[model samples]
Target: MASPTRPGPAVAILLARGGSKGIPGKNLKPVGGLSLVARSVVAARQARSVAAIYVSTDDARIAAEAERYGARVIDRPAAIADDTATSESGWLHALGLIRADHPAVSRLVLLQCTSPFTTGADIDGCLAAMEDRQAACAVTVIEDHSFLWTSGPDGFGKGINHDEAGQRQRRQDLPPTWRESGAIYCVRVADFERVGRRFCGPVALYPVAHPPVEIDTPLDLRLCDMIARSGEDQTTGVADARLRPLKALVMDFDGVHTDDTASVDENGIESVTVSRSDGMGLELLKKSGRFRLLILSKERNPVVSRRAEKLGLECLQAREDKLAVLDEWLSGNGLSWEEVLYVGNDINDAGPMQRAGLGACPRDAHPSVVPLAGWVVPVDGGKGVLRAIADRLLALA
Candidate 1:
């Protein structure tokens, strides 16, 4: 990472206020298969000039999610967490917290979790602009020349044209203008503290004209969802179809979630050891108002059944030919294969795992299964494997 060019000391402040009147909890909402917070965290970390990343939020859930995504969380005070609190206010409060720790922070990069389209490259470029221009601050904008109507100091103004009979002017003849999109803002920390505004004297404009639409309402969220999911992987540029809501989460039993260990009792009953970390991960995943979970196990052990029931997971035990059982379960539940994610650990699971829309395995999974997985959780089984996967998926929001 290149050192930042903002005066002296610098840090990135990611503001994520919990309350949203236009779109509730929109900061945590998903875009491109990730929550808005997750996307920002990833991008911030990727920036070359960023030394550290902090997420400011009042909601414990948002803080927990941010930490899981590798961002430091600063507990946003109630005074600055209200719906009416402006971004400028949050920036100042976070600055105070950052200054106390570093004591010499001279630059503050105010990042909003509301927009997900900005990339780490965009952030690095914006910061680099400060180094190049030696300006007080740098802000992002997009060129927009579409037909626009403006109200004068008086209300009710018309479009640019005044006469109906006039020939349509060429598009280039119109004045080109840039609109602030709140995608990225870079400023000197000392300058920001002195003046309560995000921008200061000699503000440089960083044009990020890449196609962007900020999420400010339910309609905006839905539209971005459509753009992210339906967009083709091809170069032509169309958004992927929005992912349908998760109906069910199909998980594997041994080695995929729980450690492959068993304690044999004096009476010859076997016990499979599980981890509390795994349970914690599941609770967060379930709390997100997404899928109904189902655990499939080849073993018929009573312990497996007990644990599944304890976690509110539907269990299918002693299941051979796992695909057939999965099909039957979907038919009975009126669900489809594409809505399910199959997690597994060994070659035996390959057949069933391949049939699901998304497949995952732990890093310690069988070598073959690792290649088959769409995403491999970082931790081994009995660890926070599920949580790793959930956090990644959540960021895609």
Candidate 2:
């Protein structure tokens, strides 16, 4: 908490390390459609409480990215340049730099590049939590006790439970575990300087009770990439706005998600094939904590429903007009077309394509649909097109 008598301006310092062992240059690697570091920088810039944003890094490329997203640059010292360096050190350095020139800086927000899913609300919520409760620090927490395990001095296998039959206990019956999701952190600048630490004083915990994901390893990055395609960012001023639950992702199934292939059999059955990789990718997208994945196809085919069921996606098959179906979906589900992302690759898809606020098109989409696409993917149809597009959508967002 800043001195009660004189609360000063709030500043956000994002620390980005360009080098990574698991995924080289992961911070710079494109996620959804933007660099990993840019996600944090943009979120911080959008926070109401944050007055100034700064990026501290030793790498020139990282420094440039930070500046690109509207943040002051603080060249990190080499002593804290290696993998062994703690983020706390870099944060302190950037804080000191600010305090030296600007004595009125009161609160400091810490943003990380690894957690791309953190929205503007996450940042504001952390800062608000600190100020509202007069706490010295605040951070984002994800509650999980479902699949935890620990080892004691005996070095034995454990299920994060004493009894293997723990599944019989109700969810609330067991103790809850908190994981620091490295999304948002707020601290009183004065206290941070006084104690030379972040988590030392009276702290407030704000649970991120939405679809939350973190990018740590390559696998985590891939999962984060999947989360980006869910159209959760449909709300205007998401970070600053009150937390709103995203109900569904109304998607177009034909040329948008598939290659629009067909094969004739001896029985005179038409089977328009789909990409196996794209199907698997949708399964991953469905696994995200948030989003109601639905497939909207104008053509009637049992294969679409079968694939949707296998991927745990809802199928709205056999609709002549996707717009009419989208309207019914919104009416029944109490949503707006703008809240959805219509990914299409043909002229028939243009109706819903223009309706969704977040629209996407395949690289090989019809020329008519290309001009209306919010995101035109790079992959061709019938291949890993959806996955490639999904990856960019998540990163850009």
Against the reference, the lDDT scores of all candidates come to 0.72, 0.71
Could you list the CA RMSD of all candidates, in the order they appear?
13.5, 11.8
lDDT of 2 by residue, 194-248 (tens): 8878885898888886445667688888877766655554211232112133345
TM-score of 1: 0.58
On residues 17-87, what C-alpha lDDT tens digit does candidate 1 reach at each position? Answer: 78788888888887755678866776676565777789999998789767755578899999988867888
Q: What is the lDDT of residue 375 in candidate 2?
A: 52
Full-model lDDT, candidate 2? 0.71
Instruction: Return the TM-score for each candidate structure.
Output: 0.58, 0.58
lDDT of 2 at 267: 90
Model 2 lDDT, residue 76, Cα: 89
Provide the global lDDT of candidate 1 against the true structure. 0.72
Candidate 2: stretches off by over 4 Å: 1-6, 152-167, 210-212, 233-397
